[model samples]
Target: MSIEVGSKLQGKVTGITNFGAFVELQGGSTGLVHISEVADNYVKDINEHLTVGEEVTVKVINVGKDGKIGLSIKKAKDNPNPKSGRHKSNPKNNRNGGGDRTESFEAKMNRFLKDSEDRLASLKKQTESKRGGRGAKKG
Candidate 1:
């Protein structure tokens, strides 16, 4: 079967590597399912999700001119509960979420300056404590 972009097909996992998994598609063609495309969440290891000789449904994301096919297992599965992967600014939790709210330019600048000063002071205190205060020597 000819592999086309945006087509979903079942394939056998032929090989597994640190970067991705090689899938044997229909018509004796092999494709790569990159680690990032393995799941919606972060995939630290490909082995955790795929195994050799296992059959999985993958979506044809790209077909290169050099006959290299890019597939995504996550895209193939229909997500019943879709959650926003990106950070959405919630107006209700402005203080807790640290989200941008309607504020004047001067007010924002003041807040930023205060935050920066606080962080710097905390870092200095940590360093001082680590070094056993100023002009302290290691024994």
Candidate 2:
């Protein structure tokens, strides 16, 4: 059977790399399932999710003119509860658009400056104490 875009196919993973997994499709065709396509969430290591000779269902995402096939295992699975993979933004949280505000910019800046000065003073005191102790060390 010919591999077509958007078609789901059963295949066996032939090889795996840091980037993606190579799956052998029907008629001895091979395709790449990128690490990003392996799961809905972040995938740090492709090896943890796939291995050589593992059977997987992959959706054909693209067919390049160079005969390269891009596959996605996550897309092949039917998601009953569909939701965006990333966090959705709330209109109420928009600062530039003038939504809600408890403090003005100048007030916030003053508060930040005060906190920074406090932290810097504490750090300077700790270092000075350590330095004084070192200078007073006997030979």
TM-score of every model versus the real structure = 0.75, 0.64
The best candidate by TM-score is 1
Worst 10 residues of 2 by lDDT: 80-89
The digit string of per-residue lDDT tens for model 2 on 1-139 reads 7889999999999999999999999899999999999998789988888889999999999999999999999999888225656665677757447643777989878877998999999998899797784567665
* Clashing pairs in model 2, backbone N/Cα/C closer than 3 A: none
Backbone clashes in model 1: 0
| lDDT per residue as tens, model 1, 16-92 | 99999999998999999999988877889888889999999999999999999999998999772366433544667
Q: What C-alpha lDDT do the candidate models reach, one value each?
A: 0.89, 0.88
